[model samples]
Target chain A: MNDRNRIPIIITIMVILLIMVIGFTSQQRERLTPVEKWIGDFFMPFQRIVSQGYYGVEDQIRTLIRSSEIKQENEMLKEELHHYQSELIEAKLNREELMELKNLQQTLNSIDRSGFSEPITANVIANNSGNWFQMFTVDAGERKGVGVNSVVIGSGGLIGRVYETGNTWAKVISIIDNSSSVSFRVLRDGDLQGIVSGSVDNELSGYLFDPDAEIIVGDQLITSGIGLYPRGILIGGITDISTSADQLLQNIEVEPAVNFNRMNKVMIINPKIYEE
Target chain B: MRRLFLGSLFFFSMIIESTFLSYLPFPSLVPNTTMILVICFALYYEEKNGAIIGFTAGLIKDMIVGRVVGISALTFMLIGFLVGYYNRKVFVENATTPFVLTAASTILHESIAFVAVFLMGYPIHVTMALNRIYLYQTIYNALVAVPIYFIMNQILHSHFLKKSY
Candidate 1:
């Protein structure tokens, strides 16, 4: 073909390509299949290498600047460490009491523990940087019994759920992701169900459908013993609420107790497999 | 070949921006670097190539971040096409011009994104969105513009620009 004719043809091809991209992405949103999982896994090593390199440099610079300060702080921390040790014991006691209370509630409610499986621990290897959502890739994969729909929990509470899982790695769709949803209940109240959705601003907030539901600002939100997550695990606390004029339901905002920004380790809870 | 290279570069930049850059404690409410570099490339390259690269980069972003499809693609394509057309008309071959072009393009790109989100039936606070656009992110992108453009330009020149049309 002549050069002038070729230009128009190229433009046509580009337009066609653009349409194809839009169509493909729409399908991707609905289902991320095995192929997509493979691609994500294929790219995992590269992502890890780049993140490690960047983090190594940053850590080096930080260590250099903070070495002296760290030493002085260490002595002061040692003094405070004694008090912290005592507080740790009290905290452990409180935690145990909370767990016992949770167990009692489970027994009262006749909650099924058969589906609860041992959790797999994984290290966060990378994080999403530019996007408003908070996401991380973990080292555990299919080999380690990590699969899609697995629940990830950090120190404070639920962090996210696994969206994609591969043979050697998995990508977590954080609770901070706009598409993520968690079924939760008010721990202080009995049998109130609500859905916790993520915002574009990387904040975990949700709406309570029941206007009469007894929910307060500091009330703890826990998984509702339904859907992909297990019951009795802490999610976060209700921070703000706005009641509509009609007052059918309240617009509730939750502040996730989990410090996702500083999260390094996570426990991936796999659903139990039963044999007939 | 040029298109492929530019597309890959933009993809890589987006990956780097989302993974590594997000962690740094910058003096801004929201820090972003991928769109800025994509805008710079769009300003320098041909219009069609610019749009293609922008679209690809935006697709990768949506895939990773889980936004409704076509939002970033639509926004970046518009930014790239306009910037490319502007570069064709006005000869911007200096250091300062690229920086200025990036700042202007970043603002336009971000506004388009804001509008796109708003139009998608999502609840958006105009004041909060405006604050993010004008003060925090705009300044952050402007400050990072020079260095990012410098690196991107070097890579483009070496890998793709050398093969002249």
Candidate 2:
């Protein structure tokens, strides 16, 4: 009974320590603690393998389901088919990304912000386990100049910010996370600004600072020079204006420009480099 | 053998849950099969081993997947202790034991996590958190518990089950 009785006392101490850890981690700490970095780095290889293998398996499963008739016909041929099918899918995906990259480049060029250093490209290595929070780890990290709050841009626009960084990897929390909020300026009318936030459903909703601001559906949005984000990064276009219970703050829904589902590669930019 | 097997199972579950489960067809579910693993051991051996397993599993998950560390660890640890403490009174072997316990634990786990994250100042919609995340995950984890429980029982029979009896 002594051992059994001691469990609660031991657990009480542990629970308190764990709570303190939770509080410390919740803050916007730029670098990973030594223990955290070691663990993260240790798991990096396995996570990388699993992420890649997961995609490969997904492609294989999709191929099998799409051609169930052919799949049942031959086991040997199925293996061969899976190979060719994955290759074909990978090539198609590559082309789509190329087009997206080209479009992003064109948009950046048109915007004419050439003072910024070249964006560090990072391969998304692993997605955070659960769907409740929107976060993913990328291969680029402190070594590549990617640090906390560095803006992560995907194919279309802003994905999120680097929440934490290791020597060779960084965890990015997307704008669509329930906890994340971004300040935006309506692109159509530059002075009309608001705060946009993400919800659990991977959707964005925001309210204008000025309740009387002239805003409508289909208006574009960009990052305002407030908060951690710098000015002029494209956010998304307004989708619908909802009649909220609170008339003091006019709320609007937004369709984020980045197609988060299909986003794989991202560019990390240090805000200080360009904000100056 | 028990130590080695349990270690492998813990590491395997961590990798699979974080990597493969997220990409599976269902988008809204987390399928926390690891919680079932903790519950099974707790039911068999009770709190002493249970708390350690729960804490270790939760710690791995937090280090890898969690945005906020210690939430899962704390919740899982407490759940393991509570489950073991209550499980000590009922020594019967029933098929539904693991299943029902897993379902209950999932809800408790998610609720603790939900409250913790919310308290940490994350804006969470109540309906979305309840309907989409907590409910969906509870069903998935409960369903997964049966097979996992049987397998774990089978594996632990020689070394662990014989000792207590």
RMSD of each: 5.9, 8.4
Give DockQ for candidates 1 onward, in order: 0.26, 0.56
Query: For residues A174-193, what per-residue lDDT tens digits would candidate 1 score against the true structure?
Result: 78766678999889874787
Off by over 4 Å in 1: A1-20, A27-39, A52-113, A129-134, A141-143, A207-216, A241-243, A271-276, B1-12, B26-34, B39-45, B51-82, B107-123, B133-135, B151-165
Q: What is the lDDT of residue A263 in candidate 2?
A: 54
Kindly list the per-residue Cα lDDT of model 2 for residues A1-276, writing each as its tens digit: 688889999999999999899888877775567877877877777777887777777778878787966666678787889899999999999989977877798788765344466799987777773756888888888888887888899888889998888887888999988889999999988889999998888899998888888888899999997998878889999999865687788899999999776556799888767764
Which candidate leads in lDDT?
2
Question: Which pairs in model 2 have colliding backbones?
Answer: none
Superposition error at B35 for model 2 (Å): 2.0
Interface RMSD of each: 4.4, 1.8
lDDT of each: 0.69, 0.81
Clashing residue pairs, candidate 1? A129-B18, A130-B18
Residue A9 CA displacement from its true place in model 2, Å: 2.1
